[model samples]
Target: MSADLLLSKLEGVRRTGPGRWVARCSAHPDKNPSLNVREVEDGRVLVKCFAECDVESILSAVGLGWDAIMPPRAIDHHVKRERRPFNAHDVLVALETELTIASLAMLDIGKGKMPSDAERERLLLASRRIRSAIELAVDND
Candidate 1:
């Protein structure tokens, strides 16, 4: 299917840059153009709704099925699929929890109270997790 068909169904559609567009998502009551649409060289179209509406719902709202966006074709076995196992948001959330544990343990020590064996182990775990997160960020950066 043509991307023009999808854009025709969208309200407030406008070009952003080459092969990119912004439009109002019909799946939700969008006050602005919260939907992003991009056409790649492979003729595959990508659609994203910033309002967190699932792609399926957005497509359905426009009376388009998956075939409109993703035309079925032969799969390329040689292409490598990218995987981001740890996103920044999840990594930061984990780091925050670990830091909170260490902070509370430090406060206990400041009050002249010794942390138990479990607390010490948890502190060690926090340090390890922090180190791991740093490595992940650095390598990706």
Candidate 2:
């Protein structure tokens, strides 16, 4: 879950400035916002509970552990699909060609020199099939 969403769920929590906020520690007996919670832009939290509450205990009180609270990593998915790899150039070629052909057909329709009804239908169907194939390919491994 996003940090902002998690922070919003904490009762009596309010941002006072950039990366600086005040909140009531769920593990402590502070009546006011005695916990100073500072979140960096990268989502690393620096919390100090003035009521002598441990940071780890406080995080657990807020329904988050160390691993659970860590920011998302950009590592690629390890679960491989039972299909072929995706090639950027191949995808670009397919998309660009599909769009170009579609645009040409649209221009022809505008000029009143469109293809035969059957031929136009065939082209439209082909475009759809190609698009679906491309999407499937991209979604695969």
- Residues 34-104 of candidate 2 have per-residue lDDT tens digits of 88877665555667888889878877887777644455441222334335767778878877777777788
Worst 10 residues of 2 by lDDT: 73-82
lDDT value, candidate 2, whole model? 0.71
Candidate with top lDDT is: 1
- Model 2: pairs clashing at backbone N, Cα or C within 3 Å: none
Candidate 1, pairs of clashing residues: none
Tens-digit lDDT string for candidate 1 (1-141) = 447888989999999999899999989999899999999877778899998999999989989987887656514323434445668788889989999999999999999999999999999999998998888767655
Query: Which sections of candidate 2 miss by over 4 Å?
Result: 72-141
lDDT of each: 0.86, 0.71
Q: What is the lDDT of residue 6 in candidate 1?
A: 88
